[model samples]
Target chain A: MQYAERILDAIDMETFILARDEGEAKGFMGRFLADLGFTDHDIVFLEQVGPGVRVRARAYIHRPGGSYGWLAEGDDNGG
Target chain B: MVAEKKKILLVPLDPVHDMGLKLIRKALDDKGHSTVLLPPGMEPYEVVERILDEVEIDFVLVSRTLGYRVGELLARFVDLVEVSGLRDRVTLVVGGMAVRPELAAEMGFDAGFGPGTTPGEVVAFIEDRPFAYGGRAEASEGGKRDLTHGFSYVYRKKEIQKRLAAIAGDIMGWAANKTSPGVERARLRFQALNKGEKYREEFLEEYLDYCDELVVLSYKRKQLPDQTRFLAQDELHFLKQYQNWEGRSKAARSGIRKPDVFIQYGTGCPLMDIMHIKVCEAWGADGLVHFDPSGGARTEGLLEGYLAHGEDGTLLTWENLRLIKNFLAPNTLWQVRAHRGLNTPETVVLAGELGADLTKINMAYASLGAGMDPARITIDGVEAIRWAAHYDLPFDVVTNEELSGVPAHKAFAGMLIIAHLALQLGGRPILQPLFCRSPEVMIYGQMRDNYIDYNAAKILALQQIIDAPLWPGAPIGFLTHTEDRVQSSLTTALHASLARSLGVEAISIASSDEAYAGGPIAAASRVDTLRATHEAFRFFGRAGIQPTPRAREWSKELIAGISKVLKDVANSGSFVQSLYRGLLGGPEDGAYPGRVGRDTLLRKEKGKDV
Candidate 1:
């Protein structure tokens, strides 16, 4: 069992970035996720409020038809 | 009751915030504990001096709102208490905004309470008893509901009812003399299940005659279709293992009534479907709809076995359905759709035999939108409804032709005809109108102002026509969702709330992946909408979304249009001919009569009963 295996499907990270518009918010989200070592990430939502942009980004930890790490036996780290 | 009265000291360290301490003191007093309250703006030394001067203090409760240097101040207070040798004599507790239990422990306090801590919890802590917060026990008592309960299924509009009766009578009359391959398979399948081995073999031999070549080959050669495989022993073992795993229980509904929520699950594999079903069930879904492969409907016969397919829809089979059914919660309502394709009747029979609570059937959508011959679907759909009635399963007449560019009026006409036919046969049929941004709405700009008016009109018009249980379904918010989880979930929740406001019986909701086509819907996405719907329900407790006056206007137009379509259908002489002529939905409306099972009707031999 691995730590990532505990994630049922995907991890969504939402935050408010002090960006000027939707494009800048998306750029900041990409950099933020990339800084956190997330390569396969997508911007799920982005809306510009008066002060900043609220963004939701998702990274798929596991998908159907793939080998689910949680299903594996004898993995002590799996929760 | 406490063994003895315990003296407690409540200290408000903040200059302006003493609400938390005051509430705790009141609860302590109610619990029959002797308590002393220290005034606000007391220095750390003054609190220590008060505790020292108090006679045999049992607990010292301190409250502070988080601010600049608040942590250091709390630390200094704890250090002063320790230095005064009073830390070991009393149970020191700290709580306020931004104060966590971990931080309290780090600051040398025995316990901490953060924001939203209730007085009951603090009292329980003082009395050293476990506190049950929230309504978990009460939430577990929300049992399964029969959405159709208490509805009389009466028609309010006598003219529309009369027209529907005429159309239904014509349909039943035409179908009485007709039988398609789908109908024959259903009959033989039922007989085969009830009789002995010899009879089953004989029935199957005759059954192969009506099957497609691919089906016949699969039966004879024991080979499955492409991208499909029978479930292995290990997979079955895994299923049993998953079912037996601990902590699986019914989800709490958080007290929302009207519009019981259902999730549609068809992940190509029964194992995956069962997993998804469990996830949805544990996340407050009241029911589930099984989606079979589209190709399975077009094929002449159904495959048999515990099979897994690596595709879009699960293969409809007795073993597969039973396998999935075994894992469902006792109260979870299950619906296996038999609406379209070649296996409508047989699917209904199988679903009934497997103990499904509900089934779906619609002649118009099956023929027009789902690519089944109109004549064939009419015969098969009639038989399916009968089987559904026989099994005491409530079937829903879904108007999915609205998805194929047909206007709501034409689709409603088709749905009402089937619903009336079901009523005629003594069957309980739920009316399922698509709560979507349908092609009709898109083209006509009916939803340009808002999504409420047209959808509200659909319900209003249906209520004017009949009083059957209305379940807006087949995944509401269809064609209005995107790959964005938040947007998709918000749209689904909004639709669900609207359905709730309209007092609909039930609603079928999509996951956050409703618009995502890249892969199977992720399990987490299912929870997204469930949580959102729960929030929406909470936000509008007994309140409602107000649709504009246009809703009433559109409702009148829809009713008139439905009446016109029914008149046309009734005057077409034969209901089957009316379908062929597109009176209910024409090719111009993007509803083409399907070609599969075309000319496959078997005429009854002379002097032989059908």
Candidate 2:
């Protein structure tokens, strides 16, 4: 699927989070964020990959305003 | 009675609009009239009692900006005034956003004021001052004074004369600005004939009623002496048909009911051109003007002939005038363009005396120089009215809110003023909606020329102010490709029907090809399809219920939002630039085809490789 479509599909209006687990999704999201010109953010792993696997998955993109929303895995939220 | 400042009271409905009311109050005050404005929310009973008890008023001005309940509310107020026995004692003049003079007259108000009413008008009406140049006295009986006749024929004639004379000077000023010397000369000669007493005897055989002023020259007479010629057909069949059309129009005007449609075919070859007149006909229209604008291109010859001496390189000549005079229905509301910078006071003076009704001009065009010029326009029309005082030749001033080179709101404000100015100058003012057409959408495209349409709601909001004859030109033939499916015909019928419900006087449905090329016969044929489709809707299942209320409300909101944007931009003194920036700032790929620049399309159409 196209990236935009995938990003749309991954949106969770209820939970306000990207992927099911935050651990493994973090590494993938980190590289995507770097590609999207995000150099000054402190990334955090909020969830785990495959439940038991202790993967540092990415859950959010931090903004300068200190008001950050959840970002989907491997998707760059750039203006 | 030119005494001290007259005290005026303005009472607005609490829950309704106060914008128009506030403005009128200011106008009255600025013009040396003392004014009191009662904001909406007070009980009508209490409000009246309070005003009666408090203020020593010259005139009580009630403003109602609320909709639907206007008539009932007005009746209540009238009843209140009558029961209080103050109707005759006080010059009870009511002005409001939604009030129409005609409707207000029926409601029993001594005078009704709509939007765009100037500061001086209220004063003049209240002072009971006759117009400086014209007589305010009721027409005096001379040759024909018999009330025994069934209808007020003589009175009606006198009324028409009085009305026409009031606006004649404005018409002359308008004509002088545009008409060629040749046409001007002809017009003058024609007026001279009417000035002579022989015209009454000459027109006796034609059974002339409203058209007593036109000096008709028979077609058979070679080199007819009069300046205005009514050319008859050489062929007897055509002549008979011409006579029939005149008779039919006369009957329609006589208040006798006739068949709904009376279509006339033009003399030009059928495939390329066709001219027709639709009288007092309803296209499911509401609030639209009952006036006509088809004269711009249709009667260009007459306009050109008047502007340029013989012809302005346009085929319009004395012959064309003769043909139209003999064939076209009598008292056809002919149009004249005032903003074209070509019409002058002299032309209107001549045209009025020669008996032309309804001169449509753009007031915005005249006021483009950053200052207002009312006296110039008024005096010109007034002069014509003087010469044609007996004919009752009315000068119809048509105005718009958006012109070619003005801010939208300013243009709208100007439109309101134009109508009021017309009435002030003693002429009838007709308001035609300045509709925006989308040239990017092929379904609604027409040669990249833009007519602005703000949210449809803006027009409705305006209806909240001035209730003059409103003509809403709606999109008709934008849906062409549907083979009986959701096609242009169906969509147009729905929109036109909606427009009617909105109270438009005339609703026009454009053709599919109008966006690309000048609307030719093919386009008109498509329009015919729309008319047929509309006819079917009346017969079909969902016949006459009000259309998409949600859409209408949404449109109003959108217009309000646009107005906010405009207000913000206007504050910076670059509204046009702001509009362009907003429209052009969108994603390049997302841009509609019409807004992408006409040159780009012209290149693309020619298959030129960029």
> Which candidate ranks first by TM-score, i.e. highest?
1
- Give the best candidate by lDDT: 1
Write candidate 1's Cα lDDT for B148-233 as tens digits: 78989888999999998898888887877778788889988998877857796698799998899888887889888889898898
lDDT of every model, 2 decimals: 0.83, 0.38
Best by DockQ: 1
Model 1, residue B66: distance off in Å is 9.8
CA RMSD of each candidate after superposition: 10.6, 27.9
Question: What tens-digit string does per-residue lDDT give for candidate 2 at B141-172?
Answer: 12211111121112222322332233333344
- Candidates in order, TM-scores: namely 0.77, 0.36
